[model samples]
Target: MYIPAHFAAGPDVIRDLLTRPSAANLVTMTSQGLLATFLPLIYDPSAGEHGALQGHLARTNSQWSEPAIGESLVIVQGADAYISPSWYASKAEHGRVVPTWNYSTAHVYGKLAVHEDPAWLGNHVRQLTNLNEADSERPWSVDDAPERYVSGQLRAIVGIELVITRIEAKAKLSQNRPDKDIDGVVAGLDAQGHSEIAADVARARLGS
Candidate 1:
């Protein structure tokens, strides 16, 4: 998260990115070494001062059993696109511009808490399911399966709750570039079928 002043993201932006459709990389340090897992997380902004995140991992995953030393990190990544130097107005003016990347990302640091109770795990899974399935024509639920089957499935996984301590977010969407150069970036990205990144760049430009 090497965020320059102009690229620093506020709390609202960070929370929005965390709640979006992004997979988070959960990293923890143990006596043996650093371990990581990729999973989807649900952010509950009302749960704590900074916020809380809920996720689950397979019981066979050893990373969950190890003691989380001090703080753990969860990285949420958003749309990204490469910005070619040819898209910058300065490139033709003085050849001063170089290629770079434009992207949005957030790092959440928190204290890890593990839950093994079947009821708790079931509730977590249900919430996660609903959140992801909301946009579908027919949503699926944990209760859709047989009671015994659902219980067995829950038993095979462990629930994780991270009480957030702090968050660092960055949106490197060409904020440092001139207006014409940013416009070129948006146009180039959109032409390259990266509408998400182009939209983000446009939004950042309007915000600036």
Candidate 2:
């Protein structure tokens, strides 16, 4: 995460982005080599102020085949859009603009803890389900399902808990550009039908 000063996000911003992103790419290293797994993470704020993350991967997946409690990297990516040179005023004035990516990303470095307790793992899975579907109008809960079936299903997965030590977040939304240039970028993105990137640019500008 090579975040320039202009693109650095505050702690709250970082936490919000991570929570909203939900899914993350968790990377771990073992004696064999590096392993990466795409997982949906559940944010737990019950640990006082700073929170922790909980998730799981398939037991058959090599990513969780071995437990490495040392250092791990979890990458959470937000909506990203390509920025064309045509979006910049400088492209017309001096032809100095180049294509760039405007996006938000967060990298969390932490120690990994693997849970083996069946009770804990069951609760962990249920909690994750609740968190992920909390916003839906008619949400399904773990208790709604058959206990024996749910327990058996949970047995096929490996539970993970990350004791996060550091978080680096960056929103590369053209903060380095001047106000007019940024406005031009936003307008161009809006015109080109990239409303997602335009919204991100607007949020970045407001935060700045």
Candidate 3:
């Protein structure tokens, strides 16, 4: 979350981060303290215009059951890579630098509301299921399942709608480093075959 202006991500970056159509780490605080769960997330940037986010959690998961409805954090993590100190041109000249992580992360702080309506819950699950299966060679569909069985399963979980009050996003992709250092780091990561990290570094370079 400590994002330098040079490393700061824009709205396009934030939208792209969630558009990965992936699950996100959600954290909520309760009387019991902090609870975190990985849940598939759908963000409507338009929702923020009205001050809200809509998502759901399984009722079976106690993370949503706490009587307290405080602000929650939804984290979407994108590609990340390790930047070795050795990759920094400065490392050879000054030897004052240490290794760092290059990554993209978004934080959504919002109001949490839990819903139990069967219709709403069913839609939530169905959308999530579709999103998860969208990229599969043979994507699965909720309609593919027996209605009675799927309905029973939906009853077992909880649906939540979070109204996002704020969103902070940062791509720590070595913007703090000199161009030569960044090139060296990207080259090192790519050469090492750390494809994920390398991809992130590449994206960061673009964003920066």
Maximum-lDDT candidate: 1
| Top candidate (TM-score) | 1
What's the number of clashes in each of the models?
0, 0, 5
Question: Which stretches of candidate 1 lie above 4 Å from their native place?
Answer: none
Per-residue lDDT tens digits for candidate 1, residues 51-108, read 8898999999998999999999998898998899998888889998788988889889
Runs with alpha carbons beyond 4 Å of true place in candidate 3? 48-54, 92-96
* Residue-level lDDT tens digits of model 2 in 21-133: 37889999887688898889887767424567789888888777675647888888877888877767777789887888888888888888887789988888887888778
Candidate lDDT scores, in order, read 0.88, 0.81, 0.78
User: Of the pair 1 and 3, which is ahead by lDDT?
Assistant: 1
Task: Give per-model CA RMSD.
Answer: 1.5, 2.2, 2.4
State candidate 1's TM-score: 0.94
The residue ranges of model 2 lying beyond 4 angstroms of the native Cα positions read 48-50, 191-193
Instruction: Give candidate 3's error at residue 198 in angstroms.
Output: 2.3
